[model samples]
Target: MVIRGAGRLTAAAVGVAVTVATAVGLVLTPSSAKVEPAMVADPGPPEVTISIALGGATHGYVNPDVALAQGGTLTIANGDGVLHTVTSDALGTSGDPLFGFSVPARTTRSFALPSLAGGAYGFYCVFHPGMRGTLTVIGGPVGEVPAPPSFDQALRIPKVLSGDHITIPMKKADVRIMADGPKTTMWTYGGSYPGPTIERRAGQQTKVTFVHKLPKDAGSMTVHHHGGHQSSADDGQPTKHLIEKGAKRTYTYALRDAGKPAPAAFNFYHDHRMHVTARNNWRGLQGMFLITDPKEKKLGLPTGKYDVPLHFSDRSFTASNQLSDPFGHAAHSGHGGMPGWMTGEHAPPNDATVGQRILVNGQYAPYLTVKPGLYRLRLLNASLFSAYDFALSDGSAFTQVGTGSGLLPAPVTRQDVLLGPAQRADVVVDFRGKAGQDVLLSTIPRSDSTGTGSRNAALMQFRVRGTTSQKARVPGKLRPLAPLKGVPGKVSKTWTFDLSEMHSGGQHGSFWSINGKMFKASRMDHKVRMNSVEKWKLRNTSDMTHYVHLHQEQWHTLSRDGDEPPPWEQGLEDTWRLDPGEEVVVAARFTDFPGVFMLHCHMLDHEDHGMMAQFEIVR
Candidate 1:
């Protein structure tokens, strides 16, 4: 048995150039013949001059002011070897053609930007979202960006499994196909529970030696680097053709640094193992993959004594304490939790009540003992369909740390942290009360924590054990993030969606929808160029709050309908719950990697219950 190497990766300063660092065949490699260079002596890519600094030529910012006059030629220099493009959203909102000009390594091309006016233009690497730049065109005063984050040298990171982390194990579950309950099935990574946690440094390498232990019916196990960009092969797409059960495959990949002043505070990983993402993730085949880049680590933010990654989830258990995949046949589940939602293709009485009694990692009602001082609880709502307008029982405040995509430059104290399905919050809760006193955690009012049958509560009792040592204290601030650059004028398009409940068949089919319809291939959501900004609005009509989430991209929560916290909601989030009859707006940009992605409710049941939609992005 050969053990796969969790290799070391260098945080090489990136300007522009894709290095074919290493490639090991996942399953097997065939014999090949070597070829000698026939024409060139020192063969390499056609070299051109490039600006290796962050921004402009690299993944950072361009000079604050645009030097262009009227009808000046715009130059797109490719620092990264992989194919790239310079696109704009000035044409139209939907279906805008991209400026597909290829700049090989070190190459640069000039194009005309007619009638240059003062505005912000977004740029990105066609292959990687992390590689992006901001172009500010100024005929007037330009904008200013905050200073980058400063990292502390003593950030505590468990040396083992810290950077370039990998793990492999038997995937077992009662796989569901369009819902119904428990059947014999195999899973990858996180068995019938949230899978393994793969942690790594910002710039590192990892490879998984995966073996399919499924039945003869299935032979696929793919790992989806949920927050990864650049390398598409590691995206973990399952194919009909796979290594047979009992056979193994090794997947290797590198974590390229996104040259920001700060580090990516949080990211998640899960099984992209193909057609079973819904089933595998639903069957507890899910876990968190964290990246602690060196830059952020150096930030003197709260260390191990305060920071903790808390996964939140909710599950319904039977009298026997067995978790039944009630999300099967979600079509039969009520607007809340209904029966026949977890099982695959099985039917049951649609009126059955589904109450989630257990909170696993990110679940409801999980207990955690804390000290009587300030403790930063990194809460991740990894639930299938639960959202928390979370607040402390005594009405304590939570100093928010970060969102889905990354962290902000400063901390914002929040009264209630609202997390839709898949949404997360880095909150610093000060346990300043008496030690040994019991603290009760509860969900905020708007969250409707009470379930359909009664009140829904995601809280658990937290008993303070002791006081913290003075040597360890929460930092004045957490990791700072790259300043949010400006976007072009209203050149972007508009997108709208509606969420509501429906009644179908003889039973009350509990589900919501976008744009008043379910996901249909024939129906196009919206199309846009590679780099552009657009305003998206989600109108909720259902009685329950549906947290809508987007993948592969990060969006900023602009504002809610009321005086509710909008600035606090500005963290990078993949999931956000829409309270009943409330409308939320998001300022978003669709960067490189032209493809179609799914946008669904964070509530797994709501998503499987037909509350899902898809959008397309093109170059």
Candidate 2:
């Protein structure tokens, strides 16, 4: 069966209970009943400015954490183009301290911290889940220290869910995840970090009843069947059918094939809770969805244990071995709808939280024992940010087979395979006759496939074992893809990705926008004719990378920067990460079913920050 990646969630700081009103109620009167000037008090001690630096996917702010004195005024500058809030449950006595304090994009907000006992305090942006920091209130002189990741041994692979139809319960549980040298507490589904994999067959109907049993503080959830082309009601779009704590909803997928010639492929399912997606996913509310067909299987591709589904992601840990960053939960007044600007209506373009440790199936530097033969490796870039250019340390070439959506026209042999957030690639690793060999799977940093040079960082390892007579081979003629040279589609529309507002103080932080407008769920940015093929051009105007993803249907990448895409991208794809100032054209036919689908940056944080837009497919 084909495979895709899922998301995860974690826990944050806990302190006293309090509530604060974020909105100010305005009183109406006849000409505003002699509004008096608000009393201007004497300005207190000057604040120490802490700028929230935004850059790179997977790494939002350069200084996400900070240290300060116990009793001092603070100024936090939102250096990106998005709204943010610095709230700590450790602060305030009567209410949620974050309620009235919000820092607009490219602006700064100052606040006075009540004199407190010297200790550590955690803070985060209410709008962006992964945007978190630590405040070490030094009493005397010693400063605060940042927590490091917990890494350890390679454990058993993440559990895979079988059976054609099944019941998936989204529950609150805990699992010990080892990364670099230690095991950390990770919130999970079915007591596993990645939950379980769900498998199905093409042209077969499947029923999945998602039961939610998470605690109230864990927040509400809706399961999005990512990469599934189903009706709107079954799409699991946020706010459509949310299962609050203790509530359950069953989503049924007809699971028919798109009939696009490409072999059956894999996708993923995860929590799409309107606002807290980053946190919920960071807590591990995601799993894989697999679809099988006779065509690909008959080709004698690696099946069963030999065909592996690998999920690549990164996460950070607190000093106590608890999940930090995206794992921490923020206490927002409520979920859904547009938030106030000060609270950040959207996420900044550079707000993709990259973790410190790269994990494969929840294991740090995991080593997979593979038979000395051919193995079909399904690679899914499940990271919230971070695009990877995969290559073998031993200089072994990877035979490109297929992708998250389906198989390519033919296999392409190359050393490096670039995968962005939410993207997938299926490759055949020929380990034939090589026993007791340790091959390192590394990532080429900033390997955008531009004319620039590339750097390498080791990710995971492959330990080759005994040989097998059951030879798994890559078919000479895999599948046929449509010729992009004469693809039948007009350049009907164009979408440009860039900053909407340059924030208040001209800080580097800016809100991600399409066509110069922030995302609004109620707004329909585009309209498509049902079952009609159309080509859309995407232009990235920002200096950061943006992975564009379209829902409901997989698209055929026609060209990149007026040139043919890499051979690996010749087939259908649901997401493509574009570098700064890059332009690409893709074609898609919205068939089967379509209502209101989203087209957005796959950097989940960016999507949460208003970089997403909706389009309707009309009959």
Choose the strongest candidate by TM-score.
Answer: 2
* lDDT (Cα, tens digit) per residue for candidate 2, span 13-32: 11111111121111111121
lDDT of each: 0.46, 0.63
Q: What is candidate 1's lDDT per residue for 72-180, written digit by digit as tens?
A: 4555554432233333312111111111122333345555443323445443322222334444443432222111111112111222244343446555654221111
Show the lowest summed lDDT stretch of 10 residues, model 1: 1-10
Q: Estimate TM-scores for all models.
A: 0.58, 0.72
